[model samples]
Target: MSDWGVDRGVRVLKGVRHFRHRIRRKMDIMFDAYLNSEGDFPMCDSPVWIFGRSYSVNYDLDELRRSVASCMWVTYRKNFGSVGETSLTSDKGWGCMIRTGQMFMAKALILRHLGIDWHWEPDSRDPSYLKIVSLFADLNSAPFSLHQIAQTGSTLGKPVGTWLGPNTVCQAFKKLLSSGATGLDLTMHIAMDSTLVQSEVKRLCLSHPSINPFASATIPSSSIINTPRIDPKWRPLLLIVPLRLGLSDLNEAYVPGIKAVFEIPQSIGIIGGRPNHALYFIGYAENEVLYLDPHTVQPTVHVGSKLDESEKAADETYHSQKPGRMSFLAMDPSIALCFYCKSEADFDSLCRKLTDRFSVIPLPLFEICERRPQDWTTSDPIFMSSPRSNSSGGRNSPGGFTSIGLPGSSSSNSKTRMGSSSSSTFSGDVDDEEFEILG
Candidate 1:
């Protein structure tokens, strides 16, 4: 044989060896994950709360494990298609915040479709549950996939493969939901400036005439046909309140209020973690926060269009049997509190809880008011009517909706809020001057 041909054959053998090595390394990681235990839950007597429902460590430990395991655990995934135009195929290092955001949103979806009481079983093949899982699959078409979130973040000035802050993730999800990416008929309202205006949320939730409440009752999938049913009543709401509890560390005073958040029935969870790390904070037991960590890296798996054994096996990676805990004081102050209100009554109850419970605290994490403060300067409008606006150009536009960026246009008084030692620092971007001073 020619010398050149022999050299080409040698290169081919080396390439095959490299591929085999990669497969073995991936298998070893998977094996380690299977054997690794996430540590037992705290045996302390403090009542365990997982997304509003409370459980006792002594008796309800089994139920607690089920609840924690049922939560959709999104983590770093590899071998998926490149994110946007970037060549990076894995989010092992920079996608924790995005993964946490996906987890938080997935909880909201669970409440929306499967109901808060729905439980996950290993052999269960409920269509609604499967549909939710598919929406977050690593595929590009998945509405809440990492690819989509990273792409949306890029539009919000966040480059792909970069770590996203809590506020940035919330904003990105809000935009994605507004684009009708998730056909769940839910409205996402991000309470900016640490103030959740009751009127604004009601308007956003109740003003949508195009969304059919009946049609959204069931999960949307390829097999179903939407008849354009319209219900101007109350649409399900995903409320996200981005807060900064302290300048550098979480303030001890706000810890009580944070704990109280889990007691509220509408609570989804909080998206925050230690500096440089992100976690999905689902509940709390006394001083420690119970969370689902997204630090583990797993090879991406696709959930097929149908719920079969292969799809079910692939989804097993989306859940964790063990729940991780962290002390409240160890958390980063910059966080986003998530809630899902399925009905008008739920929203009312949430507001009442905020007013009655959170207000009593010395320093409330946030405030709820019936209307925007009169003295505060008016900011940009939250929603704008599309070209299909109704003849009545009033607040309730039956046509459709589109959302702009943050409410305010200028950052003149942003520093004043952060400069004060007692006040919580707030910023829209991670390392930028665009701060929204909470009232």
Candidate 2:
């Protein structure tokens, strides 16, 4: 008999049916509990309707990392690791570990929820193996490392590997909901940003309908739809830009929108110093949740929570005395991260001259290397092999491999294509989307 026939034939007897029914009922109860619990989370005073989109992997950790990173490596580097930290040679290793692991698990969880097939794996990269090496090192150096636990299945002995962080594991929970189900979307918005200095945020729906990165991939290896996601229909982000005519600090501009004084962290500083008042920002939509900025905002919170009841706590800290940070913007400082600046003086000057003093600078954006004709022939080199660069040229991105020039090459090839090939990359924020900045 076939495997299914043998396994289920007698298994479907009276007792089996009763057990299955019990299991089904238990599952229903569990699902209802989760749905009901979602209500306990906070919501905006005036909620709005918005949609979301995403495109993620559905296979081995390495596979997803390789696939996603292969296209926009600069993004991986920017996101996964520290940036412009000249004090330290920023290695992309940690970033790779965190980002790839997160993507892999997120994809897997989504697929599992969708009842699709997807795989996950441990880190096989060399540096990743260093933790294992540490286990061996500890064995040679410390008594605890040498200690062994006796188990029924033990043959002789076991050298459990020193494991690296489960950036991957953490992502799995974030994607699946410790409770149940896994669904994601790059998230679109018809939202508001009233916290001050914040622009109205919206989703950039560039992924193809089939390339919902938030949604898990149904296939493993490359498929016909393997290219970066794109769509013809444009849904311009509802550009509710405040300061319709002025300039402000990028940090204060896009603070992730956070509500409720209760969810605020208990401490905002350390013993003898200020506790961190800033938090990784997330948002709510029609009762759904959205992950906004995670880091970069702590560039120094320097904000006063008007609703904070901890006046004694505030007086106890030296750091809280700093200038007030614009709080109304979405909480993420990175959201305000733009190279553009038009200082108060510049704006005042412009106002005096009856002109707009917006010294525009491009915000950080994902880069994609569009395969275009290489005009320069020189295999030149720039400062020890052209400074490391993002291949997907964004308006503000540095030159990539092209930055390197033969000993005798023109300056033309050195110019990086920082912008996308298409003017319509963003269906929503198009007309005013020229990567502008003002001080």
Candidate 3:
């Protein structure tokens, strides 16, 4: 907290109060109506993504089919085994259920293009979509272990063979991450990792810190894996895609030669076990849909103040990593995003960079309604023809099972984690009388 006091002229005057102006007018109107320009509504078959001129949109196209950035382009297919292309889970295919089926059909077409209707109970084989159920934390804290059950609510107990509320394995993993296709009993894996800082194990944790104490021996350098447990026999499948990055790129240089850029719209590790440090706006990954394969490598490390003309071996593999510029979120619990460091006396105010329209980051449906979630999924829809729409209605009387699904392979078993659904009636988290439903 001391360095942010002067270095670089009041650091842009205390970075204009955590980037005000209603957070840069909500990331300049959602980055200029879905990746800059074109937001009066009406563009169905939703899915747009063009780079070279910059792009980033997802299903909402209709009425005259406006330009949707020209149309289609998300990538990650490596699977076309039919049934929407493979999934026995040796860590999935067709690029993890068509990129989480265009990220839960673009979060239910941005909650029905912001109009928000359908009074719950949808899934009579996809009525357009709506599964909202959340629990988190178990299997010994498996990837966000339900964010420690929302930071420890109810003090957390039920550890053995868990499964309490409406569970059909979390309603068959929110009905298979909302894309369609299910089959799993137990057998899942995938790998491809990254998160450097070795150089002979940081000179042996700075020459033995009380003989390698812990934080995995001196706060992790970063890592993640399982792109098909490939051949350790198996034991790797972990998904937590919530995304957040920007702790000066993964620590190791606070000032001199400054440099940072960990993008990873999902691909910084392709899927192994040490390369997932790219984060951008808040991140999460314990389950809600995670199918895999998103790499775009090509940076030895240059970043900021002119690192060979702002680096981009091709837009840093779909650039991503933004959580208010990091403070703690990566020790590679099968990583969703990293370089936050938690706190150790605020490593130079958590490695600076929280702005240039990082504008305090937030929004993404208010960061998944402050993650008090019982439902989730979003991101990666540069374009492929607005391919994410499903909203049915029927079980208003059942009230069961929640979310988890992602069985492409690993020996294939048929997804698990337990479920029963029906919880987020929208009463807890962030309070003020709840009722968010967003637009």
Candidate 4:
């Protein structure tokens, strides 16, 4: 062979070797995922609680797996369009928190359209399920896509391709839902300063007049009628409560409260994880918290309005068959709890459950008040502004959590009344002060 021929052969050999390496790496990932799906879960003989429903390990193991598999799993994706003006096309490294927020909001949509007991089948073509999944596609058109979340974060002082904390992601979702980008008839209310004001949530939920709070186009009218209508004045509510359970690690005192929230029917899930990494926590088994991890990087899949055969296959990427688990004690101190109330009765039931569960505990996760304290004020420009208002504010620390307290109160009592004082201004920055839970 001539010298040119020899050089061509060498280049061809290198290309073949590169192809083999790529194939091997892909197979290894598949093998790892298969192993994880087959046998990574811990043996929890205790009853498993997932989003208010319990399953028996011995008898309902299959049911438990199915219940978990039904949740929409949003994760890191690559090869999508650039987010905003940045060249970043993938959210692999810095988008975990945003993905967790997507998972949380996706669950709310599922509960709203498919009901609590809705099960997902591999080949099932449920219109509502497909619709819900499409909304989170990586494309820019999807309302809750990574592209939208990242761009929205930019408005809140979070630049594209940067890490976001649980509070910032929750705020992003609130802004997205309020912008009317999502056609779903639901409202998001973020309880700032670790305080959940009943009157505020009531006003937020009831202000919008919905003909049928439980109605969905995919659901038949008969099914809608069967769903009990507690009150016509109420609109569906997505209540996001951002809390700093502890300064660094999750406070052991708040463990029981966190577990109890998962058992409430109104509970959607939680968007939190260990420091830096983010996870979508759905349920708990004994001391372990069950979560859907977003660390896996997958190729971008486009889900359109119509669910064709190819689209159905692509949609499978959005659902995970296996759930990740870790000790609740291992969770980071910064976290956001999500809940969905479809009616007035549901909201009332949530308040009752919260009061019953947290009232007796010495250190409650957060306080529930009928209304904002008489002396309390709402001066957080970022949070208090209209949904579409483009207001700038200080960016929250990527891993640090935010906490609010009564202004000028130097008391360190755990049970002190951290009323909403008008003199106090809310900041995204973290503080050493503790939140007071209103009885």
Candidate 5:
């Protein structure tokens, strides 16, 4: 007897009809499902909408470390033998390790949420990796020997990889947005001296030259978007920035707007003595603020040496993992740095939401980036003075939001003077003090 005939004769006791066809169709569906899975399936990433553009947010840990060369490698050990194999060096690059993992994760989250394209592994020609890498290192492509610098009496010179400061990160972010990668036209209104901002990017590129860092890429070039001023059209992503702020102001000034309509997330860099540690503030529960810790190594789950299973497992692990959280006491020195948006009328709506929630005006944002312990007393001006015209003074910002025109628009060639001093050391009025200067 045929297989179906034999099965039917033995299993005909049930009242179900079309059982054979139903079983075959179900099997077909399962087969299709298996074939359409990640890694093995080779489909585009899942789409996430941002600024009216659809971007793929589905990415893995390996894509996170591409920009920093030294931190790209991961070591593995074999259970059965003494030796283990190291695969692709794409795992999340742990630069500052316990210190700055949060910053890396925060940047990764920002980039992911914004839907900007990131690492295209083993593809040297792609610019996305270069852009992200610039955020980590100077990217001049210098020789390895020059990358390390020794301190007084230090036998081994410390490896000076291309980890950027908070200011540099802000500058690099503006650069990326202006590069046409982000569909929205954005401008960064920095409160610090413009000359310092210009010089910082130049210094990074001089040390590391292989990456061929663009000079214009250093600053967001304060420019206005001339796109069709209508719905679904490009408008300025105005970034109102501050150099630093105390913990109280961190919660009072930045936190409310953060909790309100706009989604400009703040990253806490330079906590107490740890300059490398960067924590992205997610939200607050009572007096405590929750954040994501990227210091712990996220492993790539594998099984039986099968490519399909390993890929599937890694993807599953990424989705299931949750960001770690912490309380307010965890923040030493009680200082944090961040940015607030002040773009179009929609931003006014966001401000309105903040007012309704907290009954406070959203201007004059008090933000801070902690200082390196040694340089804490250096008194460079924290508050920006009258900047050039394109960058203006108005009620919109702590300093004010000035529209820097298009990419090629005239910028002041004259450099603004910068102090060797640091913002952490402030003798200003205690009432006016935005940052908790831990003397």
Candidate 6:
């Protein structure tokens, strides 16, 4: 047969198939739309159309949260244990204190949205691996195997199996960018002590020429937010709050840095809850806040002494990242850390949607929703006090947590306030004087 004859025959077959399929597709679409319109049809909040046909399916919020930031999920078990703090994975393990992972996760989300690659895959042939290991050891005073580093996230400057607080992460971020090794020219400002960071960076550069991390880093004189110190604006500024902050500070500092998905409020990892849990807000409803809890129970047990086997299980669990919702009253975040664009033009655009109010930030209900008896440890009351309340208050009664003192309550009767029963010693972002070693 001629080429044209064969082509026609094939086309005829395709046309008949297309006609049948198109009719079927149309029927499916009409049926789906009809079902979706009915209240009885079970479907996700958002409609998902497949091949021009709407399908009713219920999807969880984790899908939305991950989609928001392209978030990287690293379980606390893998990251914390690779660093001497292995027992932190325990339910009541007070030793688990790595708020930096929460901060890192938040930054990874921001960079993912900004179209910047923030994380690096472990490669055995890379020379930078040695430096990362050495720096991590120097910071933590613990030894780590290259295999451990490759399995979990980079340990860089984190002590093996120990506390990796937010300050260390902020400082390490500076060093990574400064070394001109990572190729990330990000700027970080220590709002609490810009001078301390400046001096520390300068000393490190001068003291160690070969291993001098952060040699090319810039030290700012003032805060990246609410300060007129930095001019000719810099893009992508990551702010670290190592001290206690109020709702007003969180609103003013974060709103300006937020963009649609990349710069959203959750990019600012908030360390809250008892035992200093680190979490990032995904979204909020009328009285609920959606968040991803980095701290979860270990998925597997370490069989004998095989750390690698346990870590592998942890890695698998992390891939299944999940989002959770809590009463706005229960999410009592103590610190807020975020990444921002500091350039004048970009900063304005970032802050365009920002308002003086924290409506965008999923803030917990700090006001006392209900007064509980001093022994009523059923709920945490420390979160109930207003964030605007004065820090200095009467000491907490026995079996009670510290109270910022209830509103309209006198100091003499402050003993009547109730709070969470967990120990107040948090291992996250806090001053040296404020931190207590918990095992």
Q: What local lDDT does model 5 show for residue 33?
A: 32
Model 3 Cα displacement at 348 (Å)? 27
Model 6 agreement with the true structure over 242-282: per-residue lDDT tens digits: 33322211222322122222224324444343224555554
In model 1, which residue pairs have backbone atoms overlapping below 3 Å? none
lDDT of each: 0.72, 0.22, 0.21, 0.71, 0.30, 0.34
| lDDT (tens digit, per residue) of candidate 2 on 221-294 | 21111222122232211111111111112222111222221112110110000011221112233323222111
List model 3 lDDT by residue over 1-439, tens digit each. 5675557667786688667964775455344323311212222232221111112223322311222211111223222222212222121221222222223222222222221222221111122221111011011122212222212211121121222111111222333322212111111111001112122222322242222122242322221110221222221111222221121121222111111112222111111111222111122111011112222222222222222434322223222221111111112111222221111222122223322212333311001111222322111111112212212311111111122211342231111201113232211111111011110
Rate residue 289 of model 5 by lDDT. 38
TM-score of 6: 0.40
What are the runs in model 1 whose C-alpha is more than 4 Å off?
Answer: 1-38, 210-232, 305-309, 378-430, 433-439
What lDDT score goes with residue 85 in model 1? 79
Query: What lDDT tens digits, residue by residue, belong to model 4 across residues 1-439?
Result: 9999999999999999999996785565445434443322467688788899887777887888888888888888899988889999898889988888888888888887788888888788777777777778787777788889888877765678887777667778877777655655777887765678898888887787656443556534422222332466787889987776654446677788898899888998988876556888888877778889888898998656334876677778888767877667667666788999989889999999999999877667787888765556443324433322323322233212233445567532221122333343333332122111100
* Per-residue accuracy of model 1 over 1-439 as CA lDDT, tens digit each: 9999999999999999999996785565445333432544778788988788888999998889899889999999999998877898999878998999999988888887777788888777777787788888887778889999888777655678877777667777887788764665788888765677899999888887655433443434642223322233788899998666666556778887988899888999999876667889889887678888899899999766445777777888888877887677667777789999987888998999878887687767876778875555423222432312334432221111112123353332221123244333243322331121210
Compute the lDDT of residue 287 as modeled in candidate 3.
9
Please list the residue runs of candidate 3 whose C-alpha ends up more than 4 Å from where it truly belongs after superposition: 1-20, 27-31, 34-181, 184-229, 241-439
Error of 1 at 84 (Å): 1.5
Q: After superposition, how far is residue 240 of candidate 1 from its true place, in Å?
A: 0.3
TM-score of each: 0.77, 0.20, 0.21, 0.78, 0.36, 0.40
- The candidate with the higher lDDT, 4 or 5, is 4
Off by over 4 Å in 4: 1-41, 211-230, 305-309, 380-439
**For model 2, what is the alpha-carbon lDDT of residue 74?**
12
Cα error, candidate 4, residue 115 (Å): 0.6
lDDT of 2: 0.22
Against the hidden true structure, what lDDT does model 3 obtain?
A: 0.21
**Candidate 2: TM-score?**
0.20
